[model samples]
Target: MNLTGGIVLYAVLWFLTLFILLPIGLVSQEEAGEVVPGTHAGAPHRADLGRKMLWSTVISAVLWGGCAWLILGGVFTREDVMNWDQLVR
Candidate 1:
């Protein structure tokens, strides 16, 4: 993959990881019994975004490294995906 493709892949992975990690271990305001004024009870009591972001970066890096290796090592190619329907025929 080119530089742009690699960057895009990492960005996608990062966001996906972040979203997946967002809900884990979260305590809703209702559960915590401290719903802030005008905020929904379902809102997080402590989002802890900084920690999640750090974990996201680390997870994305490992995932991206594996994907980059596969792409660069010729384990698969774009043509394989584009022509995937034919393989099932």
Candidate 2:
């Protein structure tokens, strides 16, 4: 893949990973019995976004590395995806 393609792929993977990780181990104010007066009960008691983001980056790097290897390696090429229907037929 080209530089832009690799960047876009990693960005997409990063956000997807972040969203996937967002709900894990979360403790909502309601669930924790500590709902603040002016906030939604479902709001996280402690989002810990910096740690989540760091983990997301690490996880996405591993995934992106695998995907990049698949794309850049000789195992598969863009042409294989583009002509998948014919290949299946």
Candidate 3:
């Protein structure tokens, strides 16, 4: 993959990882019994975004490394992906 492709892949992986991690270990304001004024009860009592973001970066980097290895190692090519239907025959 080219530089742009690698960057895009990492970005997608990062966001996906972040979303998946977002709900884990969450504590809603209502559950914590400290709902701020005008805020939804479901709002996080302590989002801990910094820690989540750090974890996301670490996980995304590992995934990106594996993906990069696959692409660079020639395990599959663009044609393989594009002609996936033919493999069923």
Task: Count clashes in each candidate, considering only residues at least 3 apart in sequence or on different chains.
Answer: 0, 0, 0
Residue lDDT tens for model 3, 1-89: 99999999999999999999999999999999999999999999998999999999999999999999999999989888999998898
Which of 2 and 3 is ahead in TM-score?
3
lDDT of 1 at 88: 81
1-89 per-residue lDDT for model 2 (tens digits): 99999999999999999999898889999999999999999999999888989999999999999999998886787778888889668
Tell me the TM-score of each prediction against the true structure.
0.91, 0.90, 0.93
What is candidate 1's CA lDDT for residue 1? Answer: 97
Segments of candidate 3 deviating more than 4 angstroms: none
**Residues forming the 10-long window of minimal summed lDDT in candidate 1:** 74-83
Q: lDDT of each prediction vs. the true structure?
A: 0.97, 0.93, 0.97
Q: After best superposition, candidate 2 residue 81: deviation in angstroms?
A: 0.9
All candidates in order of TM-score, best leading: 3, 1, 2
- RMSD (Cα, Å) for all candidates, in order, is 1.2, 1.4, 1.2
lDDT of 1 at 21: 99
Q: Could you give me the TM-score of model 3 versus the true structure?
A: 0.93
**Any idea what lDDT model 3 has?**
0.97
> Which pairs clash inside model 1?
none
Best by TM-score: 3
Off by over 4 Å in 2: 87-89
